[model samples]
Structures are given as structure tokens and as C-alpha cells.
Target: MLTSDTDAYYSPGHVAQVVAQTVERSRLKSVIDSHCGRGALLDAVEKSFPKIHCAGIDLDGNAISHLRKIRPHWTLVRGDSLAWTAWERIHRKLGGSVDVAVLNPPFSMGQVKGVNIELEGRVLRGSLAMAHVITTIYHSNPTRVVAVLPESTMFSEMDRQGRAELERLYDVEVVAQFKSSTFRGARANSLLVGMTRRKRQRAASSVEKAHYMSLHNAIVRGGLPCFEAVSLRHGVPFVHSTDIKDLVRGEAKESLRTVRPFTRGIVNGHMILLPRVGVPNKANIGAWFTEDDVQLSDCVIALQYRSERIAHAAAVNLRRDYEALASLYRGTGARYVTVGRLSEWLTNARNTRTYAQL
Candidate 1:
């Protein structure tokens, strides 16, 4: 039967559990609970480690008063967290860097009207201001930060830039997350993020590892065979996947013109017949032309694939590897087709067939 005026309040047991978990995982000699609502978090930390120093700060005087009455041993301050100078002053008074900061800051997303305000002679949004203060502390003191953030902030695509900034400045990791209807009588999801000050090189390695593991898991769960069957040739002039459909349908008016056998190349998953030289001025007029009209260059290469398998006993040699196929046709002035483009061609071809049947 605990009640509070805070936007989001957790049960004492839940807060104690989270604080205990954070204490166990982080090297927290001293803890600062920003937006400390009722001092439940402070009580939990002190209860777990009596020797560990703890402080609580809140903008609400009533909350701070209540905290002081309940836990007179804990230091309670009334101040806005977004005040950089005040925050720095408090940090200085603490004598040294804090080991950990645990916060359940106000979820001011919809409740607070964001205003463009001047801070240190720079204009910044209120929401961004709060983030800036947190980032400043993170940069100044390599403290471990564990905070509960709105689920929207964690998952919204629009916050990609903000998320990237946070990740760059901190060894940001989501330790645990869950959905609960704990805020304003509405079901709001939240994430508990754990962060530590990371060196530039170490942070890069961490980001790479996260990306690699995510990609590996996705590939495994997708149940798709490894794309080891495909090979890529950089800097190939790509035609849009849709353009392949027009070419295959003979819908390309240029293909209608009878041009000299200028050169043969593979295009859009099929063989292409182009003049040895291209037609000039006829560029606007989509038609094939004679070699004299165009210049032959290595720009275009023929992409060839085995229409049928060749047996070893036959004069035709069998090539199984993509690299081997690329090497064999390299001197022949042929290029390789990407599997993605090939798939697009196949899809369009099927669509064309379906249309014809209809």
C-alpha cells in the first residue's frame, strides 16, 4: 500500500531487487540516485552495502523531505539534474569521481513541453539538455550508469541519431528490458541500460562485436544457406531491378532495331546484343547501331553461367566454384553478376511469364 506522486513508481521490493542487481554487477563504491523518488533506491543500496556511500537528488522538495525523514543518514539534495554547474559543484564536493549513478529520471517525453533554451550560450531543446548533462557526467567521470529509459527511446527509429550519440559516448548495453503499465496509468515499456566509460579503441571493438553477433544470429535464425555461392565485382554499372523486366519483355524499343554484332555481353541475368560501337545522337532514339557509331571499351563485360551441367568425361570442363568461374572468364572480357541482381532478373522473368499466361 505504498503511494507516491511520481510519474512512475516501482514497488519497494522491485526497486530493492534492481538496486541489488546493479550493485552486484558494477564496481560501485559510491552511488548517486538522480530523480530519487522516496529514497527507496537509496534504502536498498544502503541495506545491501552499509559501507557504500549513497546520495539522492530530486527536484521535488516534498520527495526530498520525505526521504530525509525516513533516511536521515542519506544525503538528499534538491536540484535540477540538467543544471551542469550545480551538478559539477556537487561532484566536486563529493571529493572524487563517483563509481555508479542509478536513475529513474522523470519520463518527460509527453508530459513536458520541450522548449528551445540557451545553455552556456548554446541553444538546445529541453530533452536534449537532459541528455547532454548525462553525457557530460559520463565524459567527465568514467562512472558506471544504469538508468531506466522509456521504451520508445530504446526502439524508436527516429531516435537513431540520439542512440548513436549515446552509444559513442558510453559503453552502452541494454542489460534487461520489459513492458509494464507503470506510468500515468498507461502500459509503457522500459529498458534498463548499463553503461561504463570505455576507451575509444575498446568501444570500437565492442560495437563491432555487437554488430557481428547480431548479424550471425539473424543469419542463423533465417535458415538461409550461406551466400558463399555468390561473388561480387565492385564498381559494376547497375541497372535497376525493374529495368530487367523491360529488357526481357522486348519492351525495350532499342532491342527492336537490327544492329550489327558489335559485341556480345551478359546483362540483367541474360545475354545482351550491343553494337561494337554505340549509336550517337540516337541516344534519344532508343535503337541499336553499327560499331562505327560507337567506341569499344572494357566497360561492359559478358556474364556467363552454365545453362547445363558439364560432365568431366565430356570435352566441356565442369566449374563448380564462383571464383573459378570468374577467373575463367576474366581474360574473355566478361564480368560477374551479383546474386541479388540475378534474383531480381528471375523474379521479373516469372512476372513476365505470368502476365503472358494471363
Candidate 2:
């Protein structure tokens, strides 16, 4: 029974179970909830680790008061987590960072000005509640962090920059996706993420690759550009997965044209053009080695490659490892492969090539 605006949704029992399991595995000594509504999460944590120290923070005084009466021994504070001052005081009172942090912060967008939380290499920037909670948890410098967030947070437009920052700084150990129906009264799906704090660096050997990075680091740049479609009279050469198949079979170039002032420039043949959504089939995996450049539609993405050898190797590896690549799709709609998913596959290719070279 967390109280927020109409957009707010409380944690479901399954999400709590996931968080509790993460806490147990990490063997955390202390836990804190940044947006503990009605203390449902704290209750779950206390049940698992009976003697572990706990604290709760919420914007609703009544919610805080109600929880305090039942668990007076725990420190429950009422404050806006988006503000740095509140966390500063909380840190001083706790005397140090908590061992684990479980948060289900509000989901909303607004400018959070004048607050800078340092991560391993960069600062997360956004006006979203999710961004604030993530930065706040990072500021606390906790050893482990588990949060339940909307599925869109996986690769949504609004949280792209912040998500990139988090990926760069932390090791995302788990991303368990569940349908929105999992929540008693919600309509949008969500993800339970398990992240642990560590210094950012590449693996020293192949054995440590999974620990240091996922397949995502291999994607240099990707996005489905948006632009008005026009007739061939104003068109330039355009490419689709079908056109790529024709090229592969030694067929003449299909006449395709796009409007002038295209959103994305024609990508070189060295880079791979993949349908942003598909069944992970050979025809769907578009690897181009064209003499001239061509523009791509919003339905596809240009996976920029740094080396020609790397690009060629990725195409071959993707064909053989299509099953593994299929597992990277994010949403349930049309089997769309997000930038994060594509990057994961590319990273695998790069790592394999690097190891082969050695």
C-alpha cells in the first residue's frame, strides 16, 4: 500500500522474493529502502535476515510514522530522495554505506537540478525519478543494489543516457523480465535488476570476460532514425533486409530511394545492417559489403564496427550463434532486438576474435 500519484505501482510479492533472494546471496549486513511505501520491502527483508540492521525512507510522513510504530528500532526517515542533502544526513546518521540497497522508487520525469552524483567514471543525468534513485544509491556506495523498474527502463528513449551511464559503471548481474500483469493492477511490464558495485575495467583474461562486460560493449553506435518517407523522385539508395538478401545472392541492386536530408547517413559496408526486430534468421541477419553507401530505415540499425576483420567475423559468428543472439531480445513486441541486446552479441564476437588472435 505505497502512496504516490496515479502512476505509482507498489512491489508485487514475486518482486519482493527476487530482492530477498539477492539479499540472501550477497549476505548483506544492512539494508535500506529509498522509497519504502508501507514498508512492504523492509518487512520482506527483515523476515529473511531477522537480525540485520534496516532503515526506510519515504516522502509520506504517515507511511513513515506507521512503519516506525511497528519497527521503532529501525531508522525510518521522511525526505525527498532526489535531494542530495537528505542522503548526506542519512549517510552521517548510518555512519557508513549500507551493505545492500533495495529500491522501488517513483516512476516519473522531472528535471533534478544542481545534484551531481559521481559514479565510477561519469555522472548519470536525467530528470526522472528512476535516475535520481539510481544516482542516490550509487552515491551511498553500497556493495549491492536491487531495484524493480519498468521494462522500458531496459532501453527506453527517456532513460538512454542514464542507462548508458549505469552500464558503464556497474555490473548488471541480472535482468529478469516479467509481464505487467504480474502486478495485481498494473498494465506495463517491469524488470527486476541485480547490480553490484565494482571498479570499471576490462577483463584480464578470457575467463573473466563475463564478469567484466556483457555483449553490449561491442556496439559502437546504433539507433533507428526517424524521417519522412518520400517517392523515388526525391529518393537516394535505401537498404532493407530483403535488399541485403538480393545482394548476397548476386542479384542486381534493387532500386530503392529515400528522401533528402535523411536522418542517418549511408553506413559503410564494413558495418552490419540488422533488422531491429525479427525471428533471428539468416535472412533477417543483414550483413552488407557494398561498394557504395546507403541510408537505412527506422526498422533497422547500423552496428558500427571499428575494424573490417571484426565486422566480417561478427557476421559469420552471428549466423552460427543465432540461438544465443535470439535470447537478447528485450520486449515481447515483434521480437525487437534492442541496442543493448545487439551490443551483447557483438561483444562476444570481439572477445572470441581477440582470444583467437592471442
Clashing pairs in 1: 262-276, 277-291, 277-294, 278-294
lDDT per model vs. reference: 0.44, 0.60
The TM-score measured for candidate 1 stands at: 0.49
- Report the C-alpha lDDT of model 2 over 207-315, residue by residue, as the tens digit: 2334222322233222324445454555556665455556545555445555443534345445566666665467545345555656666666665444556556666
Q: lDDT tens digits, residues 36-58, model 1? A: 77776667777777777777777
Question: How high is each candidate's TM-score?
Answer: 0.49, 0.62
Q: At residue 126, give the lDDT of candidate 2.
A: 46
By TM-score, the best candidate is 2
RMSD of each: 18.9, 8.0
Please give the RMSD of candidate 1 to the true structure.
Answer: 18.9
- At residue 223, candidate 1 shows an lDDT of 11
lDDT of 1 at 334: 32
